[model samples]
Target: MESIQPLIDKAHELIQRADQLQSKEPSVRSVPKLSKRIKAELNFLHTLQSGDVELKENQLQSTNLTHLEAVLSAAESLPGVSDIFSAKHATDEKGNQKTLVIDVIANHGAIWVKVTARRGHALYRVWQGEGDYGDKDIVEQALEYNNFASSNPVKFIVPKVHVMFLKGLPSEVKGELESVGIATHGHVLSNTDDHRIDVPCFDWSVLKELKVIHAGDPRRNRVNLDVSTMIAMTSNLTHNGCWFDYPECLLINDQAIEERHHPQLTALYDILKGKQLFACSTAITIYKDIVGNVAGPMEQARAKMLLTKVRIVDDCVSKRTQELGWSNKIKERPKIIFGTGDALEMVTVSANGSFIRSASKHNITYAVDLHQSRAFTERKEAQAVTIKKDDAFKRINLEQILRDLLNPS
Candidate 1:
């Protein structure tokens, strides 16, 4: 037993060093070495505990393996020591021998997170990286292999997959993602001092509760808008009494030119200036036409200023038609332009683009006439009474109008 004293002393020394290291500030550079040392020590203790007289060449020499293993295992059971686990991967079943590539997969209460990282500027898509695979491809494979969305744990609460970029995104790209309800972060792991393997699992239930709170607001999704509403707002701009009709609005550059300040139009501009709104490519083309021709240089500048903020949605014409149940009516009917109200519902314009109408069958849920909607009305009332000194229109009870618009009584 005297022969074991040196090995016992060394083991105690290692434990003391580890305890001291744990108390000091951690350095990312030193973490891997420390983990490896602790793992090796744990292995040595386990081997001695098994009473295997023939020690493997890789294991440290120890005579009191049983006692050492017991003590080391007990230490591991300490509250903070076992805070992390190595990320896991699963092999493909089709004999591909390729493991699903995921940086980390972990359960935090009811939410299971599958994290992927893109380290640079290359667009993330399938088979676009060095190995003919990219972050998206691996995530897609993981989803299929794990069947995550419909899996038992997810049935309780849907899983949120977060894609972390180790680099920053361009403003345009970030804005696009923001429109779709995805919030991205740059170097989330490194920024927070989270070692990939040591990230702590958290309770995701709070996120679910927050989502429930915002469930009633449609602004959570991107808002789509129609051309008629644009005309309604811009025609009121007092450029001329004849700013042209629907299709004419699209070709307004060829129309007569003018410069004037319409109060309602200015108020409408104030309402929409910073708001994130989507329009069909056609509607955008019309706005560009006006900018190029109808508007004076100053108005063109204003149009150019605002156009960048409006995202031109893809397949806008077809999507609008389909939503209106006119999939087959595409060529037969007048082109259905799209618009969104403050509530994020579809704004139905008359066939002739005369005005917004509530009785239109194409209405999604509630309808808004640009002339009479609560937001427009309240702004108009404010301008007329406060700015224009027009008492003919009393101030509408805007708070009630907003409540009615949101709750739809």
Candidate 2:
């Protein structure tokens, strides 16, 4: 017992360090010397656990002659074999049921062990869009597995990337995992147990196509002639120079939106927000415009039903976010935005009528181009409305100004 004291102490230290490594999200490495020592201890533990008692047990247990020498060779080492096993994929008499089985060895008897896992359960099937389109890559941003890892003590993560969707199957989605050698490199969670996977599990490109379809509305009339009323409102709110906040909800630059030529995406968001949008009639007319300056004959005949009334949903910005506009986080054209009613429109369109309380934003999972979402580092030429020089006037609402400017008859 005294002789084995060092090994016991090393084992305890390794276990403690391993616990630390497994708890962090970024996977901090243990001190190099300690990591090496821990591996040695784990290996030694495996060897001792499979010592001589296993050797005799394995010899009497293995029936296959071909592996008899190999078993004996391993038995001679400090790490003696506990059992010898054979693996094969077997089918039933009718060849319908199939599974992999290995021989199990015990002091009393040997029995065939059924291998339960299959290619389907190996996790490769997940990214194949097996269940739904948009559903596959959409899960990338809001991955439950990654969130669970953040909560779990062990910090294990199912790879969020490197998964490919199989287009061949229409009803059920599948993966092209064989291209990455995931199928052939089975039987272990890690291809090599160096505490890291040689290949990255995520692919940014595969996650880009989150939505399958795009939609919008059409207009029946020529819309407004010129938006001077709105221009006055823009001047009223901007005070000639100020910044305001705006969310990325306005539909612009296409998440593959149809050649959307309606009101700028922000304008639509404002309509949903329930604040008065004060824009020039001429500008408002464009809100009714459709793609190609015209629609398909179906729409042409329906007289642009798709363009008449714009729809707003939760993706629309609300009062809390728009308050930044009042503060000029959105410095450019703040006045024009206020005149036309983009932010208030967003709240109205996206929220349930009775549900007006502000809550934490729901994390909608989707992959977006990082470059496209970059924040502006330097101030560009100001399209923003003028603001009062005093910071104390920041909370001033644009609505009263709009009523005064656009509606002054």
Q: Pick by lDDT: which candidate is best? A: 1
Instruction: Tell me the tens digit of each residue's lDDT in model 2 across 304-385.
Output: 3322332222222334444433322333232232322333221112111111121112111111001111111112213322
Error of model 1, residue 17, in angstroms: 84
Candidate 1: stretches off by over 4 Å: 1-222, 228-262, 266-274, 317-320, 323-336, 339-369, 372-409
lDDT of 1 by residue, 260-350 (tens): 1223333443344333456666666765665455444434444554454556654333443345443333322234343333223433322
After the best TM-score superposition of candidate 1, give how far the Cα of residue 388 lies from its true spot, in angstroms.
12
Off by over 4 Å in 2: 1-202, 216-235, 239-355, 358-409
By TM-score, the best candidate is: 1
Candidate 1 global lDDT: 0.36
Error of 2 at 51 (Å): 18
Return the lDDT, model 2, position 352: 15
Candidate 1 — which pairs collide? 48-65, 49-65, 49-66, 225-338, 225-339, 225-340, 226-338, 226-339
